[model samples]
Target: MCDGYATHNGELAIGRNLKVAFMPWKGYNFEDAIILSERVVREDLFTSLHIAEHVVSVRETKRGSEELTADIPNISENATKDLDENGMIRVGAHAKTGDILIGKITPKGESDPTPEEKLLRAILEKAGDVKDASLKQNHLTKVL
Candidate 1:
């Protein structure tokens, strides 16, 4: 049985079928890799990401046609609901390497500060006190 605890930067929704395993990280110890691909893909650590674990076929029901499973650790009976009472994504579904999923918790928009803008602002604001402007610029350039 899977421990159901997967160490991923991404969240695993309630009913999604994911191939969870301990995959190699930097060296000796393995990190819990909750991924879509059952097999290891080349250079998977950095490039090539998946958004969903499986293609959920829609049906007449608002909840869709995907079957919920109990294998996932903390999944509840109502895991297949399109959204919970609070309007968050239903818990059980998850994204994996090859699946075409939908809905992101963090929608893409101009809602937050851009990294470049923030970095540039930080440099300009702080560099005023520094003697060497070129050196600070160099450091920022490297960061960018």
Candidate 2:
């Protein structure tokens, strides 16, 4: 299981699945992370560009409500239907297979991978899509 923690800019931005691990983790002194992240990308800290991954939500919101409401602070509010009760919005889904990629971002980069990584990537490319989760994971492992 992932720890759901990633740091960014040395401060903490905690939230569900929003791993507070990269930089700017809650109240952390980013004084070091910023310098290092900058150097890493500029100096090729890992053989190539470092890629960080995260999920993006695809949510649904109604244009208007038929009959529902929530209190607004110092503002005029009218009837509104609760999104949770009607939202049911889902990210890209594969019909029949029920498989989905939800969201992903792969950095545009290339590296002189070790023979093993090269082999792994080739194998993964030949066998994938969201349907083969393992392959996708393995491919990412290689890239990272």
Candidate 3:
């Protein structure tokens, strides 16, 4: 029995397409992305090949009697946090279907302060100019 599985060499953004001469899976020559696009759809590999700064958009293909349009979908990035000045992935970074394209890392001061940090800052401000006073959480007080 023939195995119904194929490995993709590279991944394309869901809405993007790369013109190719031939595709191994289709066993034919075409002017659009072949196996990569199928993998994107079959495997449901949405966004980011392996990391941030990359995404996979579902490709769109339509064939008409006189016209053929194959529009690839746009890649969706997984990272939603604020990026540091130098924390973005470099341009022209090549990644395979299962490789890392962009690695996201928030810098120490780039991301918004956590709720604890904000609360601490507020408490510190409230306690400002008071030498012997410190803020403490009171479990006995119930928020209405």
Candidate 4:
């Protein structure tokens, strides 16, 4: 029954954890989220909760399986672009899976864009897809 999923409150990024304790949609109150979660739990329909932050996504699955017969699979953001003290945009995947990241966005005017922007640019510059842009280490960390 969970057909269309969108941001709870804050602007959705790329890979945020939906099950995060501090979800973006707090305005609606934890009660709302909890209520929905409770219903789903009792029904045993959507076996898991997920999130798509501007960086990572938290989802549920067996070991190596796609298509959520219970839901959907092969699931997959925005932050901003910015430079660090060393003037480097740290970006990557922070999922619990073994995904890969590949790309590098040329720095812009230098206001220090958010992680989302940096990652987007990197993707464009290298002409890559979201599935491939995995920053294994550094600023971006894959939770898995």
Candidate 5:
């Protein structure tokens, strides 16, 4: 009967069954309190792995369109070490907090230009109106 019930319910064992002792230690385990061994936590016996997906989208704006590139201005080389040539994170890379996952740039409106910028714009004949829009990691995680 038990076998039939388990088969019908699709139930399976999920944890280890350990031998427990009901003993009082400094009056802490007098009631329904339970104490766990340090080895259980050190070995991560109860830890579970959770997988999540994040996405980045590029769309057209009123000024210009968004672009993805690895050559983002004002960012250090160490911050973009995990990114590939396509501005995306490399597969199986270990990412930590504040790491850039994707390097993006968006166009911005033109304000008052400085003397150097005006000279460069006049020589190059191109207006610099873009700002960094990179995606950064919120927590320490591994990219898979």
Candidate 6:
């Protein structure tokens, strides 16, 4: 019966058998505290990978529709280095925490423009009434 059960389960191993000692170390392991060796961390023997996914959606708003574009205003060039021309992170890009994964802009409401803004708008022939709504990474991960 044991052989049949083992054969059905395919002999799955879930845990590693490590050499354990029951001695206290530096007065820290007094009450069931476990002390791990430096090799465990250096080799990453128990490290696990966690994957998190984030989605950015552009929806219509009362002011106007949100847009996804690479031309985000008031952002530094270094922040958008991983982003492609289509405002999306390139595949295989390493995204760090607080890095913009998707560049997005939302239109602002119609309000009185400042004199300097009016002059620049007239000279540039563009409406600079958009606020950045880009999606940012909350943790370090790789774009796949």
Give per-model CA RMSD: 24.4, 25.9, 24.4, 20.9, 6.3, 6.1
**Tens digit of lDDT per residue, candidate 4, span 1-144?**
232345435554334333524444757755543334565567776554443344433332221111111111132322212222332234432423332232222212325455776578668863222222223333434322
User: In lDDT terms, which candidate is top?
Assistant: 6
Top-scoring candidate (TM-score)? 5
TM-score of each: 0.14, 0.14, 0.16, 0.16, 0.61, 0.60
Comparing candidate 1 with candidate 4, which one achieves the higher TM-score?
A: 4
lDDT of 5: 0.79
Candidate 3 is scored at a TM of 0.16
User: Between which residue pairs do clashes occur in model 5?
Assistant: none
Residues 1-144 of candidate 6: C-alpha lDDT, one tens digit per residue: 343422545664465768756665666756655567889879999877786677788998765578888889999999998888989999999989999999999979577567887688779977568899999988888787
Model 6 TM-score, all chains together: 0.60
Candidate 4 or 5, higher TM-score?
Answer: 5
Q: In candidate 1, what are the lDDT values of residues 1-144, reduced to their tens digit?
A: 334456334555344344555666766565645455534455353343333233333233221122222222233334323333332334454423322122212112234445775477568852111111010111111110
C-alpha displacement of 113 in model 5, angstroms?
13
TM-score of 1: 0.14
- Global lDDT scores for all candidate models: 0.33, 0.31, 0.32, 0.34, 0.79, 0.81
Per-residue alpha-carbon lDDT of model 5 for 1-144, expressed as tens digits? 354433534676456766555666666745554567888879988787879887889998765578887878789888888888889989888889888889998878756566887688769966477789999889988888
Reference-based lDDT, residue 2, model 4? 35
Error at 46, model 3, angstroms: 28
